[model samples]
Target: MYAAARSMSRRVAAAIAVFVVYLSLAPPVFPFGAVVVHRAAAQELDDEGEFSYRRDAGNGPARWGVIRREWSACAYGHLQSPIGLSDTVAGLADRPGRLGRTYRPAAASLVNRGHDIMVRFNTDAGGVLVDGVAYRLRQMHWHAPSEHAINGRRYDLELHMLHQSADGNKYAVVAQLYRIGRRRDRTISRIEEYIERIAKRKDHEELIDEVVDPRRPVRGSTIYYKYTGSFTTPPCTEGVTWLVAQKVRRVRRRQVRLLRNAVHDGARRNARPLQEANGRGIGFYYTSPAHGMVATGG
Candidate 1:
């Protein structure tokens, strides 16, 4: 009887030990945390008149976290975004090939969300894969004066392609930087008139669905920088995958002006201020003409 009781005790102890190990090794998962977006949650993300880009304003970037209870991450979260993209701070997260994307043309619609213009995919737009996990393309938006600076130099404009994971518990953004040049950007040219229409409309909703392509010059990046960061705006969710292109594209100054002018008064220059690096490392995946597709070192 004593031997049988001892044997049962050992089994219970071993089971507890296994459970403890599993808990320690498991990855911390937050709800869609954008686990990361739903139609209602995506709508909540649009910059309503509640926030402002003006630094001095009461409701500006500095105070975004305090403006609401749920947005505490904006003020307190350590892994924030828009850090200056510099090689000096690069990490050894380099991997093979370019970003994994299977994006195609899908039904999409445009919306002027007061702070910036957004193109939301209406149908089953494809997605990009990160670390073997798939994130679906949700929408694309613009930011003037570029959010994340390259080597400490800011650009004329920035494009954010927001994506949510297959289960909607994660979010990723593919950011492209553009400088003011003589030639207009093809992606912007494709929708500049539609932006004007949004600016002119009172409701700020463009009810038409267009077949928008998420491929090409947008997805054909020979080089890019990847880092873990947060959405530039509120609840200022952390754990976002920020993949910024190293090569800067060009857009006409007029086009840049149009994006800024299309927004409302305070948000005409719709860009969140650069956040703290917090010892985070930017990873470069370079495939320049001079250097073929190769992952650079730490």
Candidate 2:
């Protein structure tokens, strides 16, 4: 009896050792943290959900509404993201109410979000001023094949720089669209270079050097499309103020490829289909003389 008891003890010890090894070898799964701010706010965004791009098993955008009780807006909301920018909409001048940006270079980190690659910027990197309210820069992410269309045209890429107001209740997005061309836009190239460095990582993230400037893409553009929309991801929270740059830039095909390689299940193409306007009027903000005198009202 004593010999049998000792043998069982040895077996239990071996099993415990194996379990510890397994735990150590497991890959870490990180929830999109800190940048999301309030715990309830993050939960409202479904920050911990396994939001996927696959459409085969009801995992795509169309099915998001039924996936969770809070995500009903994904299917039910009228105001949604990636809407088409129309020229017929009345133009608004970037005059007395022009957007004011004081963004500067700061330490940033890149994360492989499984759904997309998100880069979070330091809040100290002064954000944009919209309608006299200051919205600090939070993070930026990319969508392939352009989410928002320009005059019914979809470009090769789209970058959404998200910002939050002082109260954190209000949100604004600054979108920059890109097309494939020969011009090597320095800002985009540098960002793509960093993305390439972390492309192979899955559910992993790496902090990049402070060489990237968050203001580079918006440096030259004064024309933009402003309107109200919802978050493209789950919960599809509406009332988001969107400002899409009318001045499109060029990006190398290879750079777009880096974005493609970084995502999972060959779901690199992360853009949502253009949503219905639902009687929403669009406003154009431009200083270009070619667009005639920019009017104030929609």
Candidate 3:
């Protein structure tokens, strides 16, 4: 009887040890490898708007301008959408049969400020005439080091110009890729000059005199790869139309260096990684003329 009791106690101890090991090795129940899950939680706990580190208070007006006057009661929404192209491959066949054949470009619009960089635009607001149909511009923003890979290649920067319609339905985007080259962008030039002046003053109130023309000459074919994706940031809202422009714009190496020098989390990088395409179809639009319209996509 004594021997049997001793053996049973030993087995119980061994079982407990095995159970502890299993708990340690198991993946997190909520989100083992979800990047969005972690970011959302961090954003929620971060009060005092510390997550908006880019909006530096010490740098004063020079760095971010007069906040009270410029920003005003703009609804400080926590659910700001992220910008990216989708790659999911399901339910693609159910899309409108005119998916590739129908083209619209009339919807495009540009805004000078709000989030990152100096200017932002929404394509949904502006309509572009493409093959006669008016496609509205949705939204626009930048991604450092680019996002879409061309034959496994990346560029210095990329601009996503998303577009939709007047009825707040349907979606499209114009993507303009940029690289460091000899020819400079006039719009970028104006922004750089202003930034330099701001850096010199450091803490002075000044009305920005530079005017940035959103329209610029683009090289390469107007061919584009289209897909449906979600915002690249928190909330991870889905159903964003993506249009990555085939052509690439050129900016001087020094200009890129300037952007790299800006203070972001005491570092100079502000970009998100490419999300899973998840088997989404990427449509190619070639042979289309450079259509003019205002749109915003970020």
Candidate 4:
């Protein structure tokens, strides 16, 4: 009886060991009905220039159209772009004749919608005063090496002041070009002081609160160039209204260098190469009247 019992015990132990080994080698099981894969069309540059629709996989080249089924794969194919005032000026009609001289006082309700920690300021026609046509301040951000190339020259920095209608349908962006010059802007000085602090911490969310100043007067002439273009980021959705100031603002060379150094991915350049005009029209708000110029598609 003792010998039989020992043999049975050995068989049970052996079966348990075999079960353990099988469990260890088995592939993991995921939850039922979970998606294991996704599909989408992707965009790729035609490096070799092989001209065939089926030959290219994912989102085909600009010439060929391929629809993506998965979001992850399709994300690359979506039209997204960097923010710029220059690209916004396409397809605007020219206003012929001299522009009427109108002066208005700045309103006190100039709210800074820059990423939380709201800042407020007052403005006027010539300088900063409170009480005029109320154009709600939307969001503010930066561009590097400037977008608007005047006579084929790009500036060092550009600031975008986005504004929208009360209803949120109409949109306009005010762009101020910054060139490296001897004169330093007082407003930039204030903003930069906080930017330096945020740089040390490397906390983007925390830094947004530190950077806005409503008291700093809005400078630069209203003369602008207007156009229509898509956002410069992914899903490059087009049809945004754009207003680019004709005048360029001045910033110290050291300031530009500081910004370049402080920002992550320390490369100073961030501007995108100009895209094809795609049959868009460019309009200019001249002192006399607005004018439109057809852009030859690049």
Candidate 5:
């Protein structure tokens, strides 16, 4: 019996050591020293456990930069996101342009990451061509009460369709805002079943195993706003290409409520506060009006 117990203890220690090394060996999304990348020296440090969206919380957005040394951009970066968008201040360019998109159904999974709910793609879901570069779709997430406001009007919900280049350096996000209406969003209706399964569980993942179409939010959109912004969440990585749809979709109030309740109490109203514009361009890509995508510049 003693020999058996000793052998089990030795195996447990070895397993623990292996797990520790695996975590330490993981590299940050942004590398340091002898590396080069166009997107500034910032990385998305998204440890939601260290932050919150509650107004009364101490670790709120106002103090995210001070919470960690790597999250300095959340407070001091000039090119932050979640800004107010308005064409009254946008500088339009008279040039016909189009973004290439070839999206297909792909396997995906849903997870409640404490701060919010996310749908992560497990296989290649096609991509969009921006400036001749292909940015593959990676994941999609939602924020309650929307994030970016249009013409000084905020909506009831916002969806972020995140994509990145093949090298994992460049990022482009397609944002779709929604208002509370009698109709239901088709994409949300499909995944609502899984979302309910993990509604009360934190850090829980449910294998959807089915292909979740990422193009539903982008369909029937003739007008969109293109701008350059950063991640609205932690670490706040800048230099991200933003394409916000002008066509605001209608979503049921209950759908938005489910998304809010799926996360912890601290993140129920998870939209970040509006940041300063800081003299950046906001462009509009529309089929009518003038031409293709209108340019955006403060």
Candidate 6:
């Protein structure tokens, strides 16, 4: 009886050891779901985990839609931004240029938003009016190597002035293309001084005491291409009115570098690829005494 009891004890011990080994080799599971496997904690949480889109690599434009469930529009949406302007676009009849340009000097902040350098204006900053609709200027951002192209040719840089109507349902974006030249755009030069202060600090916003005039970028341009599209970034919200000025201004190489370095460390570019027009019509217009130039189907 003693021998039999000892043998039973050994068998029980062996069974317990085998169960422990199996538990060690199997994946952990909870009552609710399987434990999620994370690659790197630091890399996964980069940029505060706010945005997952990148211009290259696995998270580049091709995978923007798959990154998140809400970003699916980036892959399947009919209307996307950074579209190439065709040379033979239909021109619209001229009308009184309704582009209200009463931008005031106001204090603004220079911020590194991870993807680009942004200028956030204070409440005192003013905005423009389009066709009797008042849109307040909210912020402005830059894209290197130009996002939108004219006649299949892209410029050195591009600027987007974002505005929203008082009701907040409508959004209008004004794009200004720039070329490398001798003199830099004074507006960009003024803001460039604060680049280093906000470099590589994602979501960091710093205020400047100096007053800025938002109209400095497009001082005299009345000609523009108007179209309706969506945001160029993730989630790619639609219902934005895009007004790209006909004139390509000059911005020095140094100024462009300043903005680029603050956002991306000057290693990678930050422009989204051109989206398909999908049979959308773009209107080209010049301010004539009669209303202005309006293009159809933009």
Top candidate on lDDT is: 5
Give the range where candidate 1 is weakest over 10 consecutive residues by summed lDDT. 289-298
| Per-model TM against the reference | 0.77, 0.76, 0.53, 0.53, 0.79, 0.78
- The best candidate by TM-score is 5
Model 2 spans with C-alpha error above 4 angstroms: 1-49, 55-57, 92-97, 286-298
Model 6 C-alpha lDDT per residue in residues 57-160, reported as the tens digit of each score: 55667767766669889888888997988546735333224466668888888888878888899866788777778899999988988989987889989999
Backbone clash pairs for candidate 1 read: 32-35, 32-36, 32-169, 34-37, 35-168, 35-169, 35-170, 36-168, 36-169
State the lDDT of candidate 5 residue by residue for 1-298, as single tens digits: 9999999999999999999998799865566433644222223223345789976665788978776778899999998899998766544544434567788899999999988899999999888877677899999999998999999999999999999998999999988999999999999999999999999698899999578998887787766777788999889989999888878999999999999999998989999999998888776655344335233321
Query: Per-residue lDDT of 166-252 in model 1, one digit per residue for the tens?
Result: 788999999999888897887778887788888834347674445788785474566778889999988899999988988888889
Please give, for residues 175-257, the per-residue lDDT of candidate 4 as tens digits: 66788899986755756655555442333433333334432423445455656665442234455555566678788987776
Q: For all the candidates, what are their Cα RMSDs to the real structure?
A: 16.0, 13.6, 13.3, 12.2, 15.5, 5.7
Query: Once superposed on the true structure, which residue ranges of model 1 sit more than 4 Å away at CA?
Result: 1-48, 91-98, 200-203, 217-220, 286-298
Candidate 5 pairs with clashing backbones = 281-296, 281-297, 282-296, 282-297, 283-295, 283-296, 284-294, 285-293
Assess the local accuracy of residue 248 in candidate 4 as a C-alpha lDDT between 0 and 100: 80
Local lDDT at 93 for model 2: 28
Better of 3 and 6 by TM-score: 6
Which model, 4 or 6, shows the larger TM-score? 6
- Which of 1 and 2 is the better model by lDDT? 1
- lDDT over C-alpha atoms for residue 203 of model 6: 81
Deviating ranges (above 4 Å) for candidate 3 = 1-115, 120-126, 129-135, 169-171, 196-212, 217-221, 287-298
